[model samples]
Target: MRVGSRRAPSAPFPGLLSSAQFAALAAEYRRACGFEICACDSDGKLRRGGAERPSEGRSVSDLRKHAVSEALRWGEPSVLSDGIEGVLWAIPVCQNQKLLGGLVVTVTRLRRPSKAGALDQRVVSACRVLLELGTRYNLVNAPLLSERRETARREQEKAEALHLMKEGTFDTIRSIYLREEPALIAAIRRGERSAARHAINRVLTAIYMLGQSRIELLKSLALELVVTMTRTAVQAGGNPENILGLNYQSLSRLADISDQEDLAGWLCRMLESLIDAIESNSRLPGSSQLARAVKYVEEHLAEALPREEVARAAGLSPSHFSHLMKARMGCTFTQLLTRMRLERARSLLVHTDAELAHVAAACGFTDQSYFTRVFRKTHRLTPSEFRRAKRPIRNASAPKSQTSARLYKPGAAVRC
Candidate 1:
């Protein structure tokens, strides 16, 4: 994932519902029980909204409010709301005196009273299976959540430690590169090799702190990074890569990778694949204005926004803006804007059948032909071909001949 997802705000859906997991099981329970429809919710509000019995108009007064309302009565568990012809099962899912949600089943409706009574027994039996959802969703989740929390906490700590070690590695390399060791290092900065070394250090740091016990986390991958770094370094006339490669080799035992040059050559795809897999998911512990500005640019790349405008928004003079952006994102600001625009353009080509010209204009291109050339250069596909090839079936409409040409209104260029 390019972006990390935040931890869930609260214990997610109640265990019983979450735990009633398998599709086949839920299907079988309903199919065998002859359920025509069902619904579920929690906190009386039915928050976040949930499954309702197959499409139908249900007035608030007409539906099974009695059973759902029972959260105030039995404080949750299975409940049967009896009506003239059938019964609705309302099972409330709660935790810590909080009603998370529930399962409502209109599983069976029989014409005969005796049959209805018998099916009620069947519903009770299904509840036995479903009651597990509450338990599975609730009880089991606690330990798993704790385990995950601890694991993430440990992983984050390991990441931080590796980050510090990489800082040390860079400090050493940077000191050698600059050949000017400054005392009490305030900031460890290197210009070009930042990304590669960061990648190696990220894994190395992860491995150093995390892989101590296994000694084989990212085992094959580590060797590949070092070797790739070595070859790329050699090709670059032994500048950063060679110096960094030697520094890296001393960091760990790439035991299985030695004497495997042919295997290494077969790994061109793997080398690219590995880099693709490692996204720039670094952390920000402190506040940053330039970071904020870059973030704004990334979020809104569709408009033909200017660098001066963005720099102005960041409250930095254009002279100093690029340096600040490089410090944070490790890339020049223009490169960032181009990347963001290209990404958005790619998304449009792949996801929407918006006219090629319009897509071009939306991505802030000056003209359609220029967009096509740049698109081909970046993605190796012409605009129309990319649209036809990448678009989904429903969205595969014919291309629009008109370019959007939607110019910005006066003074609506930048947002602070």
Candidate 2:
């Protein structure tokens, strides 16, 4: 763009491009060139442009370079008919020095340039100048070459950004999954339902974060992340049989992000790894013992206890429990605790006459106010309201209870 250039020009070039003008212009040019078929190739596809056709694609690319070199050097084309026979001549159809494809022309019949034909070469030379001005600088046409380069650059930028984001995000997910394996396993052993869910959810949240970014990441990378997350969830004491356990569908939702099969395969591998981890962690020493303790805490949800207290009762140190949790489940002990309390509170609020404060206490909240706050934050609602909405009225018919369906669905599910 120049100092006086506007984003768009006001007027149109009629004879140059409009059908009415183009027909007349073509006729005039034909008369000037002794009635020959004239063709144009703004994209360098010479064969596609001309009716008789010379060659196209890679062949056109080669011919174009030759044409540009010869025309710039010796000035003017050789022959128009047997275009291949000519000493190629092509001048750039440029606005400034930016090469916008090439301007090419040839005589209808293969006319050899004799020593006496210097005068006709001047006519061809003049035509090239007209083309340069009419097509490149006119108000009617798009800057095709500039547009092409711009579009290519934009696509390249998107791909590069997606690659970088995907790598960083998945690294975080893997770390979170591996770090809390032991705690998750221990919780599952102890039969602590909430504990297992906490680990599962952390992984699920990570997946959601990646999914939320969704700026068109490499589909393969996204798919792999989803698969890896799903497998990990299932491994960490999660039940794949329960959609709430593995949440494979949630992982699969990211498939549209990438078309690369390698990512998809990697996702598949990750899922398998999670399944393997879960099966093996369950057989560890004191797993059943831990499971009992976990179940006690789960059934008696009124105690808002920490992972360390829970681990101590199960005869394991918090560190050991944490390791077992992550190995068995794919998330941490603290995460499991938070999920359990929240889950219990959600149930009491929805299904019982327990007030918000009482519900919070039953779910392990020491203070009713704090329980309400956490409940609001987790469910995006006040405790009383969540209960009111979730509870089926005595007179109204409703679908199956959310508590039964959602609380124990397979795969991982998130509260927030």
Candidate 3:
């Protein structure tokens, strides 16, 4: 037989095998082997076959495409298995050392042993005849086949990129905010850095997904989250001025950040600082009872704080609670309450323009005069002088310091 003809095969076999030719070959194979057969070109497109037509509710096309891919990948005949559809023999069609397309033959798993052996022999014979026809038609050298393969590869890459981008959504942000925001606050309150970090990371990841890796947009979203966190920490008892101040300074730097990694690092640092402030204002861990009593006094400082009532709230008798407070905190209930009130008064004086009477009432001192006396004694400066000085208050427990000498004695009856 003449081989390597440059003239394209007529009609159904223009440059490659036609549908009629493929069908005839498939029918002949199936008649002899009782197996379904299909053919595809180098680009993994189904050309023709007994099983190539799309059936309702069946993925025959996808199976044929996969078979074509397998044949091309291995550059030879091979067996391919599908979970739901059983096995396929992917036979590559090559001529003059060049690939043209593939032949895919379906094998039923239920066939008996003797029948299967006979079918295998028929399949081998059909593949040999197909290869010979491919060489004679010069189908393997067709330029269209190479173009189709390149086009398929490009389409696959584009599909993968789209899939990645579609994975994120606005709903993810809402879910993460609901789940992680509270956890982040609780972790900060407990002073658990690792837990706080984990919560923040989850939030960041959610935000990252929402924006699909857009660096500028992610930074903007992160800054907004930081603002919300700062407010939450303040509401949880962190100093408003301190928390807000830190937030402002951090935001100044954060606004300039455009890199994703830099943005995450800056946000983490900001969160850690907010957590530190909250931890500082929080009651000491392991002193639950003392913390409760102290919290009660702090909250009720604007009213009368009988030691009995405070101790009861802490689940301890007045005397026992007082002893525990002194041992663990180095201050009696009355002294601690006084110290907390003084601290509040100082904060109001320095941070606000409230009148001395209002400040005294707010700090739990009933009489303005008594409030002045105690404030001056503890801080060594009158409220007006302290506010005007704009200086931080000295620690009341500092030994023999000017402020310590002037400290108000706890439990001494004041006009309040």
Candidate 4:
């Protein structure tokens, strides 16, 4: 996450994907979908001698640039067209929302069939998913790359002295430590207290082996792990300034820790503190809290639930939870609850033979008339009409056009 002021590399991101890998992916696209992939910079300038180059016509060039710009702006794949030429797909190569560049592909002569357009979209979407996978791979593996570069020289010297001491001991321990590092950071990000603690123990066991009989070495290793944990904690919604200040205090205490057992306990305690910090920040509007609130509401939809009761389930005050619902969910608690109830009602109407009154009560509606009113207002169809339209037809010859009427309103801002 640290930004350096050194001269930037020629590629959009060094070590993220090599040119060979990029070309291979492009080739795969060509072989599979007859689409040519081109590499473009953040400015939408096609990379020279990288992948397949698109036509340098002004319109094609402008379309590609605009596609890249849109993808970067949204931090996702986007499609663009100049109307004359066929569709252009831009899959941005971004990390942490920082736009580096992107891959541009074009099907200049798309078929008039809707299936062709859908197939192209599907292929491009798959490519975007793969690139995102690569981005995450870099995020998880970058630290290992840097560690290897830093230890290569030390490892060479250790090899020269191997005959005079234990062989493969340091390598085995170091490998185990590196293997636990990704798991530890992942668990920390997810706020899994037990899993993080266990991974830290495994990492400490490896560090202890490497620093056997050397307390200073063990302390330094522990400090290194602390630094990694703090970075991860910050990424997991912990306050940066608070975490940094806490880390400073933890480092100051590390100097007095000379016993291996004491150091292990201290690190475990430190991990717990990081977990607490993450949980403390749960009051802030976030997907985890929103999902938890929605899940609680859904699980208790039949009950006469109040906002205060739901807020307690989400571990937030009613007022704060109201604010969170507005900020992250773009709806009030009542609106979300009503929407969820209607959704459940729709399901029960189509999937079960429940009476309208029973369905209304089961979905927390006070009465059947009220449920029908709200459902018709939101969906533009009465609950009975919706059931008739959506109910599976037993006749195999049923015309598809019979079910063409839209049953649910897609324009609603909130569904949960």
Candidate 5:
């Protein structure tokens, strides 16, 4: 198939994908996957490739609009459902951190293939291929897609960091990062990519929160992270020559970035590349699976986590995961989980003035009584007693009684 022209009249920017090329790609997807694909411009206008195929109880236009909106907002491939029985996938086409257009794939319930898992994988693969093709065809610089995706990821993380900032003071956030940095480097050396990614979020959020949104400061801190990660990667058996070359290039790029969000994105991407280096040197079998399981536990510590749920997250059967956990960590899954939750509860007790009940709930304990019993068993002090012993002195002008009220729980006596 041949593209007629580089730009479309209705496109918001130059180098818009031509209608013939768009339709050709859509037609290819339809032929292979039995789904209809359409291209929509930045303004949510259906420039080319969309067919007027209606579903039961929903119009095609409504589904297309939802796909377009979701793609633009998230800048990702999102799978959504029409209220009826159809599935819609929105794959955003971006160039240099700009959302130029997107591809929408629609498949009705009745038309879905019997092998649903295979179908889903094919859909994801097709979205990736289409995105690469579309971006490469339109962009003069193919590497800009990474920047575009990073920009979107940075926006998401920025929103999350802002939300977290509202809940903690600058010191609280700064301390969290200080504690997490060692764990981040440790995870990298162990080639636990998933855990490193989780730690990266905590570290990145703290940087964004404490940097006060200063671009130059953010760049400097980002460079510092690069140095730390590169050093850790070398310790993990990554080639020093190759790693340092990448490090120098990252520093050059960091020097050029003027936007805080872009810097955040670049740091994340660079860290992941360092992680890739570390992972390449990993010697353990199923290390990725173990890393995933550890990451899943870390993320769901506040929830009612089960062995089966965690195993599924790690893509292993429960029995296999249990055996793996025992072989690798020298402990049962439940034992590890209990230790992690208790550790988190201990940190919360020292860092924040959250009540015992609130802390218990946040750490996934059944109740304050159970939490206190476990706390006393582990540390020989009740939760309130531990807090009073370990909590730092407050400098606020509020009266002691008023400050104490925040930790007061009605109907509960403080037991030492």
Candidate 6:
């Protein structure tokens, strides 16, 4: 009788040994090399061996954790010895610059293996051979695995970046970014070129150090600085067209920057240009009370914003502050507040997946119902509809129309 063809059991890592195969390999190594063996993944989770209870006064679990952590931290083979645990060796297993996991071996203290000893050399060679085989297997049958490893590495890099930003090295930089805005604006308005230049230099230096000379990260931070400069220019009475054009130009050229120093110099020049324009503008000097009111409104956008409270904060009577606000901003205090809150709401809606009720409360609306009514009246669509429309599918062939245009146009007023 003819027999049908049979398929072999597939290994999770393909040509690499399966768990049972690895167990048999580990047993062989233990017998040949006279050492206890265990394995762990890149995240320090145990994978094989070390199943027996710990010897008296020795915790097997803690030893395994330490082994994995050491291997990952050093990114190389490391050996640790203790009176009770003998000699513990941690060997990192990596492929294509990606850390896969580690192999740990416990050697007897009686042998006392040194770095150049025959036993140590043999064990290291064996571990390297196993990792090499695993690397070849991954390359041949698991290209997707390489992509996943790269994504993990990138996430780790971002986490490190955030940690560094919070550390002492970058803390002063963050303070300048957040707290020196008013000072920078005032310097620009007063045409204090040296003071403005000093402020800009401090901020750019901080960004440079924070980005660690990485071109992509530096460009990301430079673009954020551009946004801040644009807003400050607008508040300083610079022509909107000039300020926004500079912003657009800077952003468009970010990808072309290769050197951190060049990027910093370019940004400083652009900021200075914006400040010059602001100083040269024919508009009368902005009222200090109006500036104070704007600052107060920005800081208190989430709270109840009564006109009397806002006027008091600006050091003006309610009626006079209301008149000046209309003359300066071309809108009433309530209208301006609503516009600011809705601007914040629009930003959150586009960038986050927050619930509508949460968005309402965050933008200072008393309730979701009121937020919905105002949002619909102003934008001609509900919040949900607006969000859905904004998230367009990538690479889809859709023709643009007036609907998209209206969604992005300025002067889309919110009636208070």
**Best candidate per TM-score, number?**
5
Model 4: residues >4 Å from true position, as ranges?
1-178, 280-416
Candidate 6 colliding pairs: none
Candidate 3 has which clashing residue pairs, if any? 12-18
| TM-score-superior candidate, 4 or 6 | 4
Pick the winner on lDDT between candidates 3 and 6: 6
Question: Of the candidates numbered 3 and 5, which has the greater TM-score value?
Answer: 5
**1-416 per-residue lDDT for model 3 (tens digits):** 78886864333334456656766666666554456666666655666544444434546556656666654554334455455445566655655446556776764453334654354333444444444444454544334445555555545544543454466433644455665677676666555566677677667766776676788878778877887788778866688878888987887897688788898899889988887787567654437777676667755788767787787666454666777777787766667778878877876775566899999988887468778888888889888998888744333334434343343333332221
Model 5's TM-score against the true structure: 0.41
Tell me each candidate's TM-score: 0.26, 0.28, 0.31, 0.34, 0.41, 0.29
Deviation from native of the Cα of residue 165 in model 3, angstroms? 12
- Against the unseen true structure, what C-alpha lDDT does each candidate score? 0.48, 0.50, 0.64, 0.66, 0.67, 0.65
The sequence of per-residue lDDT tens digits that candidate 6 reaches over residues 328-398 is: 77889978998888887886676667999999988887568778888998999999888888766412523
Candidate 5 regions exceeding 4 Å error are 1-24, 39-58, 91-102, 110-122, 136-145, 161-175, 178-183, 190-201, 207-416
> Candidate 6 lDDT (Cα, whole model)?
0.65
lDDT of 5 by residue, 227-339 (tens): 76677678767778778777878878877898877886887788778867755665546767777777777678887687877876775557667888888777898788888
lDDT of 2 at 92: 46
Q: Which portions of model 2 miss their true places by more than 4 Å?
A: 1-290, 393-416
Candidate 4: minimum summed lDDT over ten consecutive residues — where? 403-412
How does residue 194 of candidate 3 score in lDDT? 60
Model 5 scores what on Cα lDDT? 0.67
User: What is the TM-score of candidate 2?
Assistant: 0.28
